[model samples]
Target: MSLPTWELIRAAGLTSYFLLFVSVSSGLLFSIKAAKPKTNQLLQVAHQSAGWFSLLFGLFHGLLLYIDTYKPYSLVEIFIPFTTKDEPLLNGLGTISLFIMVLLFISGDLMKKVGAKVWKKIHRLALPMVILISTHGIMLGTDSSNGWAIVLYASSLAIILSLLIVKLLLIKAKTKKVISA
Candidate 1:
């Protein structure tokens, strides 16, 4: 069963985005491991690996689009945010998300060079990157009208939003406790 080039592009992009989600999930798992100090070092490694996979698959997706005869993407369109002639806003989100992911990639090394607080502050961009990519896929993807794609987007959003909300609440509570004491 041979698939068309367009289909391959969709598959590559969707799979890459999924890896990005997995990377984010693994990062959360690593963070929560503080509650269970016995957690394996593998968790952190998995997070790093997933990020690498996401980058690889994302490059694959971009390359496929660049080579597509139907509507070829220039290198600038591929790398620069909001520079694409086609689907400027939609594809722009993907570019912005890519920038964020790259920042996250180097954040571990930066954690030592910069203080942990600064590094962590930069890392928080992951949340916005997730939302941006999901928006990009939904708005620009061929599967935008597909029920499964919508569900995937919704479910991913729910998980990430919930986690962010919980973290925000915990931070607020901690701040309040400190102020009162």
Candidate 2:
């Protein structure tokens, strides 16, 4: 069946969101790799560039959703969780994920001012937000059933999870060394 023009526009918006997701994930990976003080400046530059791109695309995606007018969605529907009739659960989670995304973006900038401990606590929310975003995409997204989308989502999540695991192990090793000293 041929998609209507509205559907086409919606699809484009969703595709932009997906691209933002990928770019943000890659940026995070690059940032993690660049955590070393020296010899990883290139990754840091890539991280910063990709981060800005992701933010731009993400804003565009959200703005397109608001402006499309194909569907009768209110600002409440876009921003508030579980406020809409269509796909309440998914939309609710997505709303929360959006808030978390905003928090992540802000915290990235505030980390310098807030110090590492506070920033780490705030950044921990990224994991839940990622999971919520993944769930929201799969449950409410039109392309969720597509094999490539599923693979891309799963792989991105896996990469982030792996990075978290490595970070945890490194922390543990450091703690053990401190105790042994």
Instruction: State the weakest 10-residue window (summed lDDT) of model 2.
Output: 1-10
Candidate 2 lDDT over residue span 81-145, tens digit each: 89888888887887776677677678888888888898889877867876787787777777778
Q: Tell me model 1's lDDT, rounded to 2 decimals.
A: 0.81
Collision count for each candidate, in order: 0, 0
Q: Count backbone clashes in candidate 2.
A: 0
TM-score of each: 0.85, 0.76
For residues 1-181, what per-residue lDDT tens digits would candidate 1 score against the true structure? 4336688789989998888887887677676554455454776777789888897888788878777757779888998878988888888888788778778878876778888898889888888788888889988998979999888788877776776666677779889999999
Candidates in order have lDDT scores of 0.81, 0.67
Question: Which residue ranges in model 1 land beyond 4 Å of their true spot?
Answer: 1-3, 33-35, 40-42, 179-181
Candidate 2 overall Cα lDDT vs. reference? Answer: 0.67
* Top of the candidates by TM-score: 1
For candidate 2, give the lDDT of residue 105. Answer: 70
